[model samples]
Target: MTSIPNVTLNNGIEMPQLGFGVFQVPDDETTAAVATALEAGYRSIDTAAIYGNERGVGRAIAESGIARDELFVTTKLWNEDQGHDATLAAFDASLDKLGLDYVDLYLIHWPAPARDRYLDTWRAFEKILGEGRVRAIGVSNFQVAHLERLMENTGVTPAVNQVELHPGLQQEELRAFHERHGIATEAWSPLAQGAVLGDQAVADLAARYGVSPAQVVLRWHLQIGNIVIPKSVTPERVRQNLDVFGFELTDEDLRSLAALDRGLRTGPDPDTFN
Candidate 1:
């Protein structure tokens, strides 16, 4: 089994720096995919209610015989479930679907500024945290302004902020802000959904390291201190993704990758995605 390093959240909970994500994986295939990841020594699994595969994730966890405490499970609340009452109800539904009494971390899937319910929804998250149903709470797809407002109006600061980040969209300013505020930056599309794999710099580094382009990217993510969850349904790719802890990228190589950032976004804009 591979020993994945743990990133301690602001709340003192330790999460695997690299995890497996089931973003586009269908429900039926999710179980086998998750099982493959687990067998490959992955302890953290990222899923969302919106992904509609929490049940599949749960099934894999149940059958793995891997003790619950040994695994870290994360699921998100959907955009429609943004209000306080609705958020709580939706969380219960997610817990039910996951077949777990408590989740390692729960996040608001998006800020959804137009709805203006995240503040209210976060209060419910705090409530859930207080009851010990969740180890930590956080938000996803939140911009700087949204994070500032959330901290100002709320009693608890988010432990992690999951977002679409890749070599093409480095998010330097946002990551700096997270560092200042002690929030862990978790990247969803850490590889740019295969968009960054074709870059000359990435390929050169991959060749130098004798590894795949995806491993180079994933290594870059870890070296830069981002908790990355790379999704792959293929068993070989799933194992390959976890094999990124062996090498380290030097400062020059990092700069080369940094220069590749063109502010490319592969997902919806958080500021306007109401």
Candidate 2:
């Protein structure tokens, strides 16, 4: 089993740096896929209400025999659930689907800036945290301006900000802002949906390190201090994703990977998305 390292969030919560993501994973396959990830030594699992697999995730956790305290589970509030009242109701629904008394972390899945209700949503998150319904609260796809406004309005800092991040879309500015605010930057689609696996630079690094291109890319994310969740339905790949801790990428290799950033994103723009 690979020993995954933990990153402490601003609120003093320790989350596994490497986690298994369930994005785009079909509902029917989520349970088995999540089970494979757990069996492969992944203690952290990231899912959401919009993902439509929280029930399957709950089923896997219920059957995995792993104690609740030993696992870190995360879910999110959807765009339609952006106001304080709706956010609380949505969280309750998510929890009902997840069959958990409390989640390790909860997030606003997207800023949906146009709706302009994220502030209200965040207030609910703060209340949930205060009530001990969640260990930590955060946001996703939040840009610098959104985070700043959120902090200003609510006077509470998000523990994390998850976004589409990979070698191709480094999000340097947002990442720096997160660093300055003591918030952890977590990477969704960390592999860029396999877009970077065939890159010449990553291929070369993989060859040198005797690892797969996916491993090289995941290692790069870790070296750069990004909490990354690489999802895979294949059992072998699930195990393979957790096998990145054994090797180290050199400074030169890190630079080469950094140079691959093209500022491209595989998901919606946070500022514009509703």
Candidate 3:
């Protein structure tokens, strides 16, 4: 099995730097997809309640015979489940669906600033963490202001911040803040949902490295210190995505990719998405 490097979160828990994501994958297909990833040496699996595939993910984990401690499982609370009580209840539902007693990490799927319940929801997350039901807690798609308010009003800082980040939409400012605050930056659409694969710079890097464009992009994410979860239902692609630890990009190559950032966002705006 390939050894995936671990990124220590703000709370001191180690998470695989690269993981498999089940974003759009249907519930029925998710099991096979997750199984393929596990067989390909992936120890981390990212899913969400909104994805409606937690059961499939749990099935794969149960059947894999992989030790629970050897695997990292992550799930999220959806937008509708944003209040303290609702968040706790929703988390129970997620655990039930996942067939696991504890999750490695749990996240608030979005800020949903209009609802203004994330602070309350995070308090519940703290409660969950206190109960030792989760190893770490985080928020996804949170902007700088959201993070600022969260830290100001809350007692615990988020361990990770998962967001839609790709070379095309390199979240430099947000990432910098994460570094300053000891938060791990986890990228969801690390490849821009295939939007950045065709970029000339990425293609050139792939050619130079004798690898695929996806590998080049994934490698960029790792080199730049982003915990990236790339989703693919195809067996070959799933294995190929995890085969990104072999090469290192030089400073010039890194700069080339950096210049490709156009602030392109493939998802909803965090501040206004509520």
Candidate 4:
């Protein structure tokens, strides 16, 4: 099994850079997929309360026979649960569903700027962090503006910012901002949901490296230092995704992949997502 490297968050919490994600994964299939991922040596598992598969993810963790301290589990607070009291309640509910005393990381699922309640929601996150119920706190789908507002208002910087990132959506400016602020950049939909797999540049690199196109793209993410979670229920693909540790992309290859960026997003825009 390949060992995945860990990225230290702003809070000094270590998180596996190459992990598993259960986004659109159905609850019924999540357990088996997560179990396979665990067996494949993926120590990080990212899910959200809205995904409705926390129970299944928890079940897999329980049955994996791995020690609780050895695995990193992450879940999010849903948009509906976007107030101080409601966010606290939602955290308890998510913990109950995951069957864990605490999650390794918790995130505000989105800024929901239109709602204008994320600042209040973040206060709850700070409280939870202070209570030691979560190892780290973060935000997903948050733009630089949202981050700036949160920092200015609450005086707390998120440990990580999980966003829609891939070869097609490089997010250069946002990533530079994160680097300056010490916030880790995590990529969801890292492969562009298979859209980048067939690109001629990606295909050519895969051939050069003797790996799958998916692996090529994932390797690029690793080289770029983005925490990437590529999801696939198939056991073989699950293993394949983590097999990126062996190859290194050259500067020329990196340049080629950089050219593939077209400012595309596989999900909603954070500034407008309500």
Each candidate structure's count of clashing pairs? 0, 0, 0, 0
lDDT (10s digit) by residue, model 3, range 70-185: 99999999999999999999999999999999999999999999999999999999999999999999999999999999999999999999999999998899999999999999
- What does candidate 4's lDDT look like per residue over 88-189, in tens digits? 999999999999999999999999988899999999999999999999999999988999999999967999999999999999999999999999999999
* Root-mean-square deviation of every model: 0.5, 0.7, 0.6, 0.7
lDDT to native, each model: 0.97, 0.94, 0.96, 0.94
On residues 1-274, what C-alpha lDDT tens digit does candidate 2 reach at each position?
6789999999888999999999888889999999999999999999999999999999999999999999999999999989999999999999999999999999999999889999999999999999999999999999899999999989679999999999999999999999988999999999898898899999998999899999999999999999999999999999999999889999999999989999878888888999
Query: Model 3: clashing residue pairs?
Result: none
TM-score versus the correct structure, for each prediction: 0.99, 0.99, 0.99, 0.99
Question: What ranking of all candidate models by lDDT puts the best one first?
Answer: 1, 3, 4, 2
Question: Residue by residue across 1-274, what tens digits does model 1's lDDT show?
Answer: 9999999999899999999999999999999999999999999999999999999999999999999999999999999999999999999999999999999999999999999999999999999999999999999999999999999999999999999999999999999999999999999999998999999999999999999999999999999999999999999999999999889999999999999999999999998897
Error of 3 at 207 (Å): 0.9
Candidate 3 Cα deviation (angstroms), residue 50:
0.4
lDDT of 2 at 92: 94
Residue ranges of candidate 1 with Cα displaced over 4 Å? none
CA lDDT, candidate 4, residue 211: 97
Q: Which pairs of residues have clashing backbones in candidate 4?
A: none
Candidate 2: list runs displaced more than 4 Å.
Answer: none
Error of 1 at 20 (Å): 0.3
Alpha-carbon runs more than 4 Å astray in model 4: none
